[model samples]
Target: MNYELRLYLDQLTAKSASIELNSTYARAIYIVEGSIAIKNGVSTRLTLSQNSALSIPESFSLGGGSADAIMLRWELVNEVDNSNKIQASQSTLLLAAKMALGDLSQYIIRCDRVDFPPEGEALTHRHLGGGIRCLLFGSIQIHTLGNIHTHQPLSAWFEAGPDAVYAATDKTLASAFARVMILPRGLIGGKTSIEYVNSEDKNKPKSQRYQIFIDELIQH
Candidate 1:
């Protein structure tokens, strides 16, 4: 797969401190808390409140608000080709729209609300499909691919193409909650769309999958 996941967080505490975000990949910003003002130096200032999201275009420098705000930013590695050089069928467009809406249909698209108790950890495992997660509260550390990264509240992280083994543990004595969305890279209409790989000592369990309705997300 040519796509990669880039996740980062922005915290604005002081009234004079602003975050400069510039990315070559298409990106999206989700406001985890407080309010943020987004300006691209060309458009009018856009204000986003808690639980709101905004899509940003490639090659843009946007300045975010300067006071007590936490936001999760997500960007994909490859810029999607939007040229109409090759025509696509309606079915193909429908599928693409479904994928964008987080509806994988026959493929796997699961939303999991994961809670890790104090000092809790998950068995080393890998998902055939990649996913993105945002911490709702507390913090968690992820150990994967010879590296360890800790994510704090309102922070977002994601894995790339299949075979990325990782384990997660809470960073504090308090429990941590996260909302995760997992999706398969390629859709398999008839066969199972996702798989799970456990460590050698762990049992091979069936893959647990869930569906996310687009209407439900829109209402929230």
Candidate 2:
């Protein structure tokens, strides 16, 4: 299953564009433009504006009530677990990890949100970690040793295998925030292990999965 990550920005006006939620996948909605209203399955509605986000379950119905608004939505690609409950009515960017997916691996993933004050690249460091990164918030131009790329909202990039060192510089003064999901690359040749190496663990030559779960992750 393929997950969808989207970013809506600078939408001048829209009549009424909405999509119904499917039970197989969950959704996360965030407003970036004008004021908008979202309806689940009940009479109650959720009103969101700039900086506000909403979580929509697959069983719920989501639609727009205003025109010319920018909204972002993330639909989960996996099935639901027995521990999760579907909220018929609500709109927020935050969603439970277990509810979005059946597994607990979603909680093990690390999400890094970076915000630069006035001057960009306040500090630069050599990072020894690699994984799938999704830009959920602001826009950032990342320049690594390999190449330079611009990461906008809802853009995901994956780094296969391990042993990759990279650094990121915030090219925009607006601040750059993104979600990084560590993949489950087994160290001990087990399904539950993850391959991670630090300055201390570099010489060990072993991988550790560490009971990590990736059931749910923030769309960022």
- Give me the candidate number with maximum lDDT: 1
Q: Given candidate 1, what's the lDDT at residue 77?
A: 42
Candidate 2 C-alpha lDDT tens digits along 125-198: 23322334445455555544567677666565544323343334344435444333332322212233232334
lDDT over C-alpha atoms for residue 80 of model 1: 60
Off by over 4 Å in 2: 1-18, 65-67, 78-113, 122-139, 143-145, 152-172, 178-220
Per-model clash counts, in order, read 0, 20
Score residue 31 of candidate 1 by CA lDDT: 66
Q: In candidate 2, where is summed lDDT lowest over 10 consecutive residues?
A: 206-215
Model 1, position 32: C-alpha lDDT score? 66
Q: Give the runs in model 1 whose Cα sits over 4 Å from its true position.
A: 1-4, 11-25, 38-46, 58-67, 77-115, 119-124, 130-137, 141-158, 164-168, 171-194, 198-220
